[model samples]
Target: MSGGFFRGTSADQDTRFSNKQAKLLKTQKFAPELEHLVDMTKVKMDVMRPWIANRVTELIGLEDEVLINFIYGLLDGKDVNGKEVQISLTGFMEKNTGKFMKELWTLLLSAQKNSSGVPQQFLDAKEEETRKKKEESDRIADEIRRTRDKESRELEQEKLKKMLASAIIWVHVLYLKTAVGRRCK
Candidate 1:
């Protein structure tokens, strides 16, 4: 995921993490349908974290039933639903509205992997996620309101300009009529 707005690198293993990458991702704007980027070479769904996987594609197709006979990509030598496996996130992309949401989950999951601060990060992530969402939504709403107000003000000015022009034209026409009447008298 070493792409735009994503700050991961192959050399990240040696670098000490101060949660900068996670913070960047969290603060970044949501990229729509990022899962379907054509030129962006994506890490396979097989590499997806359990957090994304559990929501994106379940390893088990059984709704409430436990996969008592599970193995690597196999359940008793047969696929889930006894027909085909549905483990790929891309396979579910057609109806998936929350593609970027999965990316957020992935980034958060990576933040904790192999780190001793997993517990603290996890707790903070949950609380911070909701708080951040509220903040962002509020900001966006305010921006939209300001924009609409500005547009309405512009529109009112335009209407006033047109009315003023029309009134001036009418005034000139009436004055010309009275002047012509006086000359004829």
Candidate 2:
């Protein structure tokens, strides 16, 4: 569909509205009646509900009541028809998992990059995880270093034992060769 009806404030490729919403929306400056305003700020979250809806359906299991609660939470407690959300609002996300994950990452990254009010708790948690991982890696490195001398000593002893055994075998062969030569003479 060329999407002749239901204009948007932005020059975005997509209209960012459902078919019903598009019909209700005013395409031109002159509107016969007052209609619902398109909150461009929420365009991201509004699109997210349907985008990931199908992939998450399996996660919800057999609970119908859970869908309502889930939808409510998904909409941030916005008063919306649960049936509309269930039927048409979900599954707006890209179906390919890898692409979907990357898209979601970009979406979140854009939000964080653009916003000044990024939560301090998120930054704190990220720093904590990095510190813990670095400590674990350092502990392992120290343990390996501590055992290096002991391991090297044992390895050197093993090499000496193999060399001694080889020398004994060569001596026995030489002795047998001389004995066989004397018997022939």
Candidate 3:
């Protein structure tokens, strides 16, 4: 049974994966559907190609569950129209979004299960994924802090400007009053 599974043909699996890829493309609001580009030559995968290649590379190297978690993190990290994309696999499942994450889960699990010789690069990718997650979290925290600090500074500056303006106006009024009195005397 195991041997039969192994010989089930990569072509067939590729076709199945392709179908899911098409569906994924249609669902993407802003991102490019990356899975569909697998059949293309390496030269064709240019900068214009979306992060799907990176995602798949990461997926194939890590644990199935970890890969899913990482993908969810990526989806969440994306600020589409300045709003975070929070549709994780669990969130999608809970909300009954569609077959999007379901297919993604299948792909990851299958990739892990079918591999006879897992590459050392996969281990490296796992480390990178962890590092990236930490970096992203730290970056977000820094951004929030920076925004708050900037707002605080701006508020202080505005208050100082108002006080200076008020002082100048008071001084001008006092000068005018003294000048009028002297003229009358």
Best-to-worst order by lDDT is: 2, 3, 1
lDDT of each: 0.46, 0.49, 0.48
Off by over 4 Å in 1: 1-121
- Candidate 1: tens digits of C-alpha lDDT, residues 124-175: 7778999999999999999999999999999999999999999999999999
Q: Provide the TM-score for each candidate, comma-separated.
A: 0.37, 0.28, 0.33
Q: Lowest lDDT 10-mer window, candidate 3? A: 77-86
CA shift of 100, model 3, Å: 25
| Model 2 regions more than 4 Å off | 1-118, 153-185
- For model 2 the local lDDT of residue 26 reads 32
Better of 1 and 2 by lDDT: 2
In model 2, what is the error at residue 138, expressed in angstroms? 1.0
- Candidate 1 collision pairs: none
Q: What is the per-residue lDDT of model 2 for residues 1-185, given as tens digits with 9 covering 90 to 100?
A: 57968665654455664465445223322221112222224335543554345434544443345553454464453233222333332353223323433343343344334443233344566699999999999999999987997799989999999999999999999999999999999
As for model 1, its CA RMSD to the true structure in angstroms is 23.1
lDDT at 16, model 2: 62
List the pairs of residues colliding in candidate 2.
50-89, 50-90, 50-91, 50-92, 51-92, 51-93
Question: What lDDT is reached at residue 52 by model 1?
Answer: 42
Model 3, span 22-134: residue lDDT tens: 46445654222222222112211222123333444453543355544554445432122111222333342333223343433333333333343222344457789999999
